[model samples]
Target: MLRATSLSIVLLALCACGSRAPAPQAAGVAAPDARGPTANAGNHAFQAAITADDFAAHVQALASDGFAGRGPGGIGEDRTIEYIKAQFARIGLQPGNGGDWFQTVPMVETTADESAVLGLKVGQTVQQLTFGDDMVVGTRTGQARVSLQDSPLVFVGYGVDAPERDWNDYAGIDVRGKTVVMLVNDPGFHSGDARLFDGERMTWYGRWAYKFEEAARKGAAAALIIHDTAGASYGWDVVRNSWSGPQYDLPAKDDPAPRLPVQGWISGEAADALFKAAGQDLAKLRAAAGRRGFRAVPLEASASLQLASRSVEKHSRNVLGLLPGSDAPDEAIVYMAHWDHLGTHEGGTGDAVYNGAVDNATGVAGILEIAEALRAAPKPPKRSVLFLAVTLEESGLLGSKYYVAHPVIPLAQTVAVINLDAMAPVGKAHDITVVGKGSSQLEDLLKVAADRQKRRLVEESHPAAGYYFRSDHFNFAKAGVPALYIGSGSDLVEGGIAAGEAASRDYNEHRYHKPGDQYDPTTWKLEGIVQDLEAVRSIGETLASSGQWPNWREGSPFRAARDAMRAASVGSR
Candidate 1:
């Protein structure tokens, strides 16, 4: 259950690459590359052909200068689109986008001026938090001016409203016309008990985005999350840089909910200061927020913010390719990976490009490799396979949202989605993390494959980060398609814990969404990546072969949708 830093994980990779391989293998056995299959004593020749070198070439090309860091809607996306389309073509994957390889995702890019000021009021202290340094705020509302005044802030612990679980943070209070400041994750996180809210595996309700939405649903004018290193999973620098750039999001015309007038995060220190000013102890308030009938506490701090906004209509593309099944071409299996990063951060590093070598180039390459393997398989699958390289994932899961809305195949027939994001190119680890573990039956299929590889299955270390909802896969999950967005674990097979933890920590500080995240052949090992990819491919194979369609667990929100679809299909038959 212990979690390692990103750097430690990377170091684990480095040490593993330097070390020797496990157990003897016969000659000509292929080692796992970035593709899904691993090398052992008797790997098929087809498996060996798609070796580590194949993985390396794809990643290097995707991260290279020609792609310009693959920023969505930029020249970068153009190059990325062409490159992926070509790879799908080479693998004999026909276009999935209604005979087209590209799916248009229209986005509204907004830039709030750096000069924007958030005037904060606590007691008599009037603190002005600058936009980029102290905090960053953006409004998805298509408006020229954004404003919130005399909005009383409330600490609504987690801002979760689940009637099914008998938990409501706003049980006794009316948050309408007020601002609700909340914690980042679910309560079970601090409790560590599996009885509450899927324990460490984040539910959609635990996501900060959901918190903001719930606040808006409760008629609150604004929402803010208290930032903690453990809770949010990223540092303030990540927040600053990620939000500071041009923000990409789908047009709001499709959404029916009212937008939060002001949404942002308050640093831990700043949040503590505010709690003290309101004569309420921060720890006590946090504790109370986790209770079953927690009431929103009035911090009585009003806020006034003025941001200069600029907007543009930008279009990104989702590369879609299909491998029709031998028996059931209409039913599809989707493999999705985000193909965009922060692009070139001006003047941030000596090298401007945030190449995102491991953040997602590795993920995109995995898809290409898997597509080739599926193409080379002895017989086509009964269900078709969809290889998707979506855009604006770093910004949001926008490209995927667009695809689901305009899917070439009906959403009901889409069997499953296996999302590979930020695959670790480090050494082989002892575990593979299934992030949204209990959402569907996919976890069992993965466990079977991982066990065969002598690897353990681990839950996500930072579930409060809402990693399930954070990536492109969330779009599919929300659309009633069973989804999997697993991660490469930080437990090293050879070098052990210290080395694994170090690699993860280093990545957060040095490479994550930064210029230094370029292709690092000297440091990375594709062994772990191959293990994860194969696990995904195995799951896809499982779904393709099984006549029975898997559904979400009994209590899942998606269960009703799946049932309804199944009933209609039965009626038609």
Candidate 2:
């Protein structure tokens, strides 16, 4: 999860609509045991390997203020990597990247000047939108100075141009040298119509990254998404906090995607005001935009913005450790988590350290614990198990992207990827929420493991949030690897589903992507996390031992990529 400056209203609405918070815990009330169904499961050897104490210890050390939030390219990165490497060594795993524990990811860091402003003009009336409040803008063009003067503004609906779905928001419109404004998510989300863009479930087209790329390909001077708490899956505060910090991206020369001069997000209130100034109703436009054959509308106003930025080139490392397979060492299973977060942002109130306790400290720690468990197993996995703690994930999955480009093991031989990111602090539950649940056969293996724990598997509670595409695993998925992302369930045994849902809402509102994400052993229920880890370990072991090569589901977007890779492999053999 990306850092946010404000609490998300959409997050609140979704949580409330689906499940209300459970009753508050009385002072000094003990939390549930971290030992879930695994304690009595048939797989005694596997269950005995993961422990609550070990998991809690890892999170506490990684999330502690001593690491300075684990920001990539910052001093924190140095500490985080060394810590992960030392842990892997302690567990007796070999260095994964050809005798080296680290893989260098080249990046360019850009920090926009705080004084930048977005200027809007309609006739003689001029409104200047200040940075961090009315809007958040930046330049990914690798230019120190960027400007757009008197550029005409156009509303491009969701800014999606998917010919496969017969949807094109920019039809019959020339957006060259113009500023394109669009909604945050896809059509089906706003209209609640199943026929439009995966119904309520968000597709890749709805992501902010896709919006900017599509706008740039269409030759727009800038692309700005109108942020709504419900639509963006985050609050205006989140937009501000995330965009204002130092931004990292692959070196422009390395990145092939066309990028616009300016890309950012505008607060919902600001977008509505702009709509009114242009003689259109924001709500009405959204409704019409969700329908088929909607045309892009030109706003009667013009927008101008100048951004001044400072740039630096640096290299961050991806920490990798391997438990080489005793049998087929070339074939592998990968477990990954990002080891970076929003570094120290001086602008934050109270505490400036954006301690990402849950955002990713938990992920890094979880993988480390999993590594230890695998090392202690009675028999080594038949396929190599690579533990990857990547850097710059908060900076748009750059490290993972780089790894995929320069893989330690060929993508074709890799069996599957299991990613853990921003795990919740809630304790054991009756089920596990698998993000992007139906995409591949990996879930089938997960179901077998979950069944052993006497638990069930459920889809992500908030599919509309588009979390499946938000983490490091997406890079692997795009590379034809079947990736699995699961989280602690919201079906708490103590407070039941109500309690579980309440815990989740509380984290999204107060802790997610914020400095408030500090670890609290006094109240934390690691049993649930430990339970989840055991299941993940079980899945990896099963895949490693079996001859089955899990494939993507029939119509999954990544299916063709996997199929082509498999066919090519067979031809090569």
Candidate 3:
């Protein structure tokens, strides 16, 4: 659901957490307050409020062709946000942002000219690579015409500069005014060494966004990532398709992290060719790059590319609806889902719209259902609940990023964030998949809730793909707010794990990101998603009622940030 990413592989390999009976509390973990009168009342009301028919109805409408795929900065966005706003109002939610239901997100959209080819000159052997086949390039400079003339090419392995981990790919290398090429994922992945940067689990450093940011920080003129299916977790087609369309970003003023004049991905074959021309073996160099103290390799090749692009400044809205608490109104629990998908492809042959039914229409509908349950409860939560339907998630999570920067409630006061994205439609399951498990105490509460439902919590099967970092919750996690993102388990109650895996594989191969991702009433089974929503509601209700603030785990990268923020708040008080 997070742009061109897919979780079918992870789902296919899902393993059960053993027994289906109510699980006992693990050693030293506190049992959740599951038996509280208020919680029970809320749970009972939740079951009544959240219905499969209602969820299916919402998804059907949102993913219908009339919404035109819910693209931001288009007619689809207008209809989509208004539908969400109308639903919130119907459910008795107050406008969240200063009496306004929408928060304006300023964006810069750049559509590159796909006809432009990447020119490479390795010692007078000029190789003109075709776009969309050999490589795909774009610029974030917001300039009309971007041109580079024979810049020196350097291979900065992974392009990571992490002093805390004592791994610096750019160490002792001056890549200023040159084009730097890097490998996807991190050294730990290729090396299979647990000692290097979280091993298979991708750190933020492994993300392509981070690679470009680090490249820009090192004064590189341009950056290119070598695309491999294993490292990138998707095929070259995904890279091409995702990068081909109009790319959106927060305005330079709003997001001042860094920018790249040119950034894109090249196929593995293209990389091998370039390396061979430069008198280097890509495989050997890739192996060397994974080792500690690996220096930057000078390719002895120069690269040139001219990207001509059309740019536009536009504004999209983040739809917010609030259910105010009776007591602690300032404190809040946030449930969010992106309300955008790949818009209609104009001038295309057939089936242009990418109706994101399971991709995120399901998620949006999920929040709406959860909102109804919360509002229907006999006793309201002590802390407020905010239902946020954000935009531009397909374009690098710009909406959530902006909300984190400019929140209606302060991050210190915000309790936790629960994100729902791409809920599977494969019926009921015996378990639920917790993305980025063991990151926070929220999972402890989730486990308790699962146990109550005769279900168990299982970690994502593929950690190397970095599924945790791919969604909207990652932004909240970066800001030190404990966040939880759970997926429907692959072990179906009726047909078991094999059937679930088959369903996931079918979706991955045929419908994911394609026009076929439409809502189908005949085939879709909403029982599993309903269960997932119930579990999420339980977590939110628990946190909202209690004064307890869930914190990141002891060894998590986010723990320090949470500790600092809490300490500062206390000192200020």
- TM-score, one value per model: 0.88, 0.91, 0.92
Pairwise TM-score winner, candidates 1 and 2: 2
Q: Residue by residue across 245-307, what tens digits does model 2's lDDT show? A: 578788877778889899988888888888998889999999999999899999998999888
lDDT string for model 3 (1-573, tens) is: 222122332421111100000111123222222342122112222234789988887888788766777878876777788888878887889999989999999998888888898988987798888888999888888999988899999999889999998989999989999999999998999889988988988888988888999999999999999999888776787677677768888899999889889988899999999999999999999999999989999888888888899888999999999999999999999999989887677655667777788878988999999999999899999999999999878888789999999999999989999998888887888888888778899999899889988898877766777777777888899999999988887778878777776786678667777779889989998888888889999999998899989999999989999999989987998
- lDDT at residue 358 of model 1 (Cα atoms): 79
**How close to the true structure is residue 311 of candidate 2, measured as C-alpha lDDT?**
77
| TM-score of model number 2 | 0.91
The reply for model 1, stretches above 4 Å from the true place, is 4-49, 191-196, 199-201, 347-349, 555-557
TM-score of 1: 0.88
Task: Let me know the TM-score candidate 3 reaches against the reference structure.
Answer: 0.92
Worst 10 residues of 3 by lDDT: 14-23
lDDT of 1 by residue, 243-326 (tens): 675776678774554677667777777778777777779888776665555677777687777766777786778899999988
Ranking by TM-score: 3, 2, 1
Weakest 10 consecutive residues of candidate 1 by summed lDDT: 15-24
